[model samples]
Target: MSDDLPTISFDEALPITAHVDQLRQALHDHQVLVVAGETGSGKTTQLPKICLLAGREHIGHTQPRRIAARSLAARIAEELGEPLGQTVGFQVRFARKHSEATRVTVMTDGILLAQIAHDRQLRRYDTLIIDEAHERSLNIDFLLGYLKQLLPRRPDLKVIITSATIDTARFAEHFDDAPVVEVSGRGYPVELWYRPVTDGDHLDAICTAITELGTRDGDILVFCSGEREIRDATDAIRAMDLRFTEVLPLYARLSAAEQHRVFTSHTGRRIVLATNVAETSLTVPGIRYVIDPGFARISRYSARTKVQRLPIEPISQASANQRAGRCGRLGPGICVRLYSEEDFTSRPEFTQPEILRTNLASVILQMADAGLGSISDFPFVEPPDTGQVTDGVRLLNELGAIHDGGRRDAVRLTQIGRRLARLPVDPRLGRMLLESDRLGCLRQVLPIVAGIAIPDVRERPAEHEAAADALHRRFWAPLGDDAEASADGSDIAALLRLWDYLRDQRRQLSGNGFRRRCRAEYLNFLRVREWQDLHSQLKQACTELGMHRNDAPADLAAIHTAVLAGLLSHIGLRDP
Candidate 1:
């Protein structure tokens, strides 16, 4: 232990604080311990410190989201009175902040999985904490399964699984019935009001609820289904011109500066419209009221079609309760559900694990790349269906990622698979990059592949949809001697053209100027930044793999060929 360690103080009011000795001992006596702490229990920030105090050297804490990872690392570092990246640091996609002196590393679960390639044994950390395990995301389930296999080999390693109060026993039982320490939340009373939406319009209901709550004491947290809902509700609420209330939006894709504003002090009351990201991954401060619309866009994959679908559906009962609990942290609070109690009771008890719901191709490819044995043998908390596993393997084979081993389940990474595994992209996008390399059009295809990874950068404001579309049409590739112009009516061509235009503008303008240009052109500035960041990361990965850019000019046919390699299954025949 360092002699100059900052004097640490625990907030006695936190429920998790009371379990310090018990948690520390649990860690000491057991190789794996499960912690079930509700929202506001301080478990997310405090558990890592407990690991450090238990004499654990380096700690690796995994969060389900990048925002949560970054925010939690900052909070923990602040609490330690140490500069960020010194005592506590975070690593998310395309962003890393950590130094040699750092003892705790907070990272998205995907980042940790990526580390499995370089650190197969995860030997750098003496302890690993998987936070938000109750979310049951695909990555968390895979990490849990991976750790289950790894624990026996690395007996000295300590694993702490933390989740909300829901379904903690299953996690404990998964780890051979590891001891579970349940901690209560802030003991504040929250009155639930079931105001079922008589009409299907959530915006009207949210606006009506806001009108009712505006006269109250503290900030209001409204849970919208997704970003569009947040934007729509923000507009609707602002239209009402509520007196002295600040309307804000919170979601995963918002810029760091925008997200910081939600936490900053504000006058009067603040109305925050957010996605499920706020449900458990983040805690917006000073929320004395909650508005639950009872719906969220849940990602479900159709193995038959091999398409990932994000459809707005009623939230599970566990999720609904989690959203309601957000308000109770600050004294007495009220939660007005936009749905009736009968509707809430009709929903599922808990959410289906993402492993069961999402495409398993990426997970299978990663496992094959790491030589983690067959996916079938992997010890997930709930193993995916056999057909889904088979479909995943088949997709890899179609992408030339797996060798023709004459076995449906046998997974052996081919040369192409090896390169695909090196890049931190979806297997489909990885295949496109490989195809681009072979077609000598990596430069043209790089942006398109990266663009496909994120939401479209083009923005069409509701009020200016026509103008936005007209301005957006400026990027369409010209057809010889034709008055009508399009990207040959291909989405890939449009992406390339927009990417080229943005790159040119970026070269001519300052950073702020480029952002202004994006706004003027109705492009999603944050999404553009995300596209650039992901592209840069992919480029760096390609360079490291000795795949240099081709100096050839733009090749339309070659670009389409490269793209086609990734979308063979997506092609359909149109009947005239």
Candidate 2:
């Protein structure tokens, strides 16, 4: 090893190590290399070290979720025998932990996309690893397409795309038939037992499966579609009254302190109920049995209806396989699928790329701001439907983000669009901000926009739905109740009331007291804090852009007008 090279060690137990030399040689041979490693292949944690060994410095790696980036950074730094934020660090929204000495910086793919707006050439990184590309998120697809265009300009930059065995060929083909290195998993045999739900209740099926696996000697991992399902599953399993077992819930909305329970060592076996966030984005340890319900909340945007919806849909075969692979990590394991094998075989080979199903308005804004040509002409790995592209452009036009050039193919960003692109919120919310600036009510709109951009701060636990609802109603401004307080029957009024209440509470109460009060009020303290953080971030972005909030008293009418500018499409006429 050269004296300047960082001394790094790899766990021989991990299957990815077997192909280290091949990966190194491929890096030397090509600008882009695709690695098709299954879940538990240890590719996520070890790939950065391989890049370092290949003589690449200052690597930028992206994970789909903030938790994954932070956890993986900690794990990699520990493996390198250094403290976190020293050799390996991570940056997520509102959180950063990197120093001047950091060589490997892991961040969410969205963070990388945001960086592209400022650092067009990505001069900070010599090697970029797009991890879990098979997820095919909007940010990932945009990055893939952008990198494809950027590779020729920056021949010195090396790119590595890591994904499971699913759709690796398409990724390779996207990069001009880049060489692919396949790494086998840990080789633990995972037995799949199909347990289709005959009772029409998945919770019952999950409980029955848990009862059947009661004899099993390892921790159980149940895959639910969302937080609501997780909560229901946790209650269902608890109702079973299994002894010596702890039930835990995992999801993206969870606070860091709550998420830590899954990683910490405990005495009894645990039943971890989680969303698809666990499928590939996060890897929970000590999972020897997986109960997959074969359903997840998939985001889809309807161009005709102009609505964005998250519906519970069947998981593709690739996602099912990823869930099953989670258990085989520790040892020989079993996966009890709550759907028929024939159903699995009949499902799609892969989930639809988010680019195809999602609203492309934000994406179009991003591309336009990057000076990329029309959305139709951008080199997406899988080109989106032309109608969807038109809808995106139309939405941008509606928001005054883009203006048509004399030529039909020429799509240009307006000043409003450039400002919208600079703010990290949705284009609709960004439009609301701009309108607020015009209405002289940015102070009132900033928090509402940030609140809409995040998961709701009010949490209704399954067990205390009524209590939560009643407490939440305290913030509601009903019709004819208070002339000054009501926001013309707009839900934004409720949000403002809640924000005001929280702000008042925060001022008077200590940190711990505020958190306790939030809990008593059935509000997610972390989410409330996140709301505040985002508001602060938006405030700072506005300041930098020279947009100022008003000092006048709150005006519900002007606020409603400002909010309506962004939601014109959502308004409907009622027939009398």
Best by lDDT: 2
- Alpha-carbon RMSD of each model: 7.0, 7.4
List where candidate 2 sits over 4 angstroms from the true fold: 1-6, 198-201, 235-241, 369-373, 403-576
Model 2 gets an lDDT of 0.84
TM-score of each: 0.76, 0.75
Q: Write model 1 residue lDDT over 1-576, tens digit each, in one string.
A: 466566667889899999999998899999999999888999998998888887887999999888788788988898998888997999997789999888899999988988887888999988999999999887788789999999999999999999999888899899999999987765588999988988455778988887776588999999976565577578888888888889999887778778878878888889998888889998899999999989876766655545544455789999998998998897999999999899999999999887777668877877777666778888888877887677778788888888886244578888988888777676777888889988899988999987876667788889999999988876566523242734467778878888988888989996558767988898876567657766776788898788868996867899999988988888789999
Q: Candidate 1 — which pairs collide?
A: none
- Candidate 1's error at 201, in angstroms? 3.4
Give a tens-digit lDDT track for model 2, residues 270-360. Answer: 9999888889877898899999999886767654545444456789988998899899888899999999999999999889888777667
The total number of steric clashes, by the backbone 3 Å criterion, in model 1 comes to 0
Worst 10 residues of 1 by lDDT: 478-487
